[model samples]
Target: MSPTHTDVPMAPAELDPCGMPDHPDCGIRDVLDRVGDKWSVLVVVELASGPRRFGELQRAVDGISQRMLTLTVRRLERDGLVTRTVYPTVPAQVDYRLTDTGASLTHLVKALADWSLRHREAIAASRHLYDQTHPDHDIR
Candidate 1:
């Protein structure tokens, strides 16, 4: 059987006595640096339901370009957040599943998704107000 979600292992670290990371450039930011890319987060969230084939993932991730998705999945796999499997069919097919470590992140991704949904209206209103006040600025 595949490992359960709770078996996901937390990254071991060398932290200071203050329960902080020892490196000057360490801390949550370091993690964000790895998984913070929007595509990576989306991929994790997408794989939460179960393993998905490459095309399914690309479709489910919405506007992500194929190249971007490939890079994102590769990065996540490199970081031990995902596992890729290839089937030896007449036309070999590949699928990606979250490792135990990656499964642990699903809840956080869900929370983030929930928060975004809840705040969508407020965010749009805020953007409208900002645009009205700064019509001369390029919002993009």
Candidate 2:
């Protein structure tokens, strides 16, 4: 038997837990890892409306520390999902806006957010029951 592709030996398109192809160097996984974090989702949604400065994003993304925001945008920039621009001003203003790829991802993000909202109460109840049944451990 031979591997399907030899680019990354022993790594071929295989289903992951999420049903996405599980393989080393899989671009899908690479993209998901970059934008699948909660911070990434929130950041992308916040910028979906338009570009925002660092402080604006910090405020828009509740509970996100400035440091985490910095890291998130940096990752997005590296992924080509967002653009970070600096302008010469009194304080050298910085702004972030979604790239075409990032804009394309907003619909997916919104769908996931909507699903979470729709199932919030059910999920809460499930969590409560699970916690009661497994008091000795944290499922999270």
Candidate 3:
């Protein structure tokens, strides 16, 4: 039987943690459109090190608001990419870890990061040139 939404895996809520929606035209461009945000990439990288508590993840990711983090975690969990474990304690604690599926995407994320780092200067130069050519427009 074909999977329904409930039967389908979930991704982190805040972002498209599974990368993108399933469809015939779900090309790489579509996947990028879904989870290509800077925040999503950073979160994945941070989670790759190991499981982390909500606060820890927030701190690790940098500049992510609490709401955003919560949403992101939810999406990841729904997508079946991230697993959440809650431990009962004096104040209750929750940790998030990447599932095997999520871990599989780490290499792609890392490669993207590496490529960005390598081409940052060139990208900056391109932006500068574009700005100079079109003073009234910001093409970045």
Candidate 4:
């Protein structure tokens, strides 16, 4: 008889105090490092709408340099989150679009953006209070 699903042993759900796995090869940590980057998040959000050309992405992302955008998209493509297509035009146009996995992450990204907009004022106030309380400790 074949072993049932429940009969299979499972690895312990071990995590540190911060809720992250203690192992260096943790998949969650790798993904978070990729998507949690400021440039990656912005690029993914822009691609969420539809396919866009290299110049369009550079402009829409605001303050991202050409080299940085190139590196960011390459990383996203390597991770299977984005696709790059080249058109056989005189200038050789290139476009970027999110894969299904990347699209799925958009919802969470939008929620985080909304939350930031909502609490920005409160966060600024908190920062001011902290600065006032810790004048000597303020780095800036």
Candidate 5:
């Protein structure tokens, strides 16, 4: 007789002995990596206001390179988080806006930003103290 669903063993890649995902590039990790990227976070925040052109995003994101911004937007597009609209003007303008899914994520992102702002001073002070005590491992 064929094994039942419950009789089948879980794939090794699905979980480790500790019941955690075994693969480094698991779905959750992949999503987290994209969402947690600095450029992606900033791009998402900027798009939260409304649709914006490429140049506007470049300017708004502060230090992102043209190439980096291009990659970030493409990744967001592929992930269904942003939509790119092309306007057939003389210069062929392109604008990016958050999709519904992306918009939903903005609330969580904003909360995280708010939390960072609230704790930044304490975090900085802790970092400074740590750096002072561990001069050999000082990051600054």
Candidate 6:
């Protein structure tokens, strides 16, 4: 039998891992890739409370380098998930906030955060077991 259009082998949906047929062109993967990094998630959560200036955000998301923060913000801005506003002043103030779409993703992000909190002990245990097994390997 010949392959029907629906039966033809198609590529895995690049955008979403869910592979739903309806969202053929969804940019969800690109969006996830952009925001999947740790610093991005931290920035999003920090901005969820309210808009923050660059330096303030840098301070709030501890351990993030200036370069990484700048890169993460730029990626979020380019993906339309975050908004950046600049004010003309002697100090040249700039602020970042989440877009509506980004706001919608907060539930998912929080769910992940909740899971992380719940599993921290288990994760630590697993890390301890692995470290014992691999001796000399630093799994930080």
Q: List TM-scores for all candidates, in order.
A: 0.79, 0.80, 0.76, 0.81, 0.81, 0.75
* Models, CA RMSD each: 8.4, 10.1, 7.8, 12.3, 11.9, 11.7
Model 5 TM? 0.81
Cα deviation of 114, candidate 2, in Å = 0.5
**Clash total of candidate 4:** 0
lDDT of 5: 0.85
In candidate 5, the residue pairs with backbone N, CA or C atoms under 3 Å apart (3 or more residues apart, or in different chains) clash, namely none
What is the C-alpha lDDT profile of model 4 across 1-140, one tens digit per residue?
A: 23352232333444213345565545665578779999999999999999999999999999998777877898788778999999999989889999999999999999999999999999999989999999888465
- Candidate 6 structure quality by residue, lDDT tens digits, 1-140: 23342232333534554355887666766666767888889999998888999999999999998777877887778667899999999788899999998888788889999999999999999998999999988658
Give the top-scoring candidate (TM-score).
Answer: 5
lDDT of each: 0.83, 0.84, 0.77, 0.85, 0.85, 0.82
- TM-score, structure 3 vs. true: 0.76
Q: Candidate 3's C-alpha lDDT? A: 0.77
Q: Give the candidates in order of lDDT, highest first.
A: 5, 4, 2, 1, 6, 3
List clashing residue pairs in candidate 6: 15-29
| Model 3 lDDT per residue over 4-29, tens place | 42243444435324444564343555
Per residue, candidate 2 scores C-alpha lDDT tens digits across 84-119 of 999999979999999999999999999999999999
> In candidate 5, how many Å is residue 134 off?
0.6
Off by over 4 Å in 6: 1-28, 136-140
Error of 3 at 51 (Å): 0.7
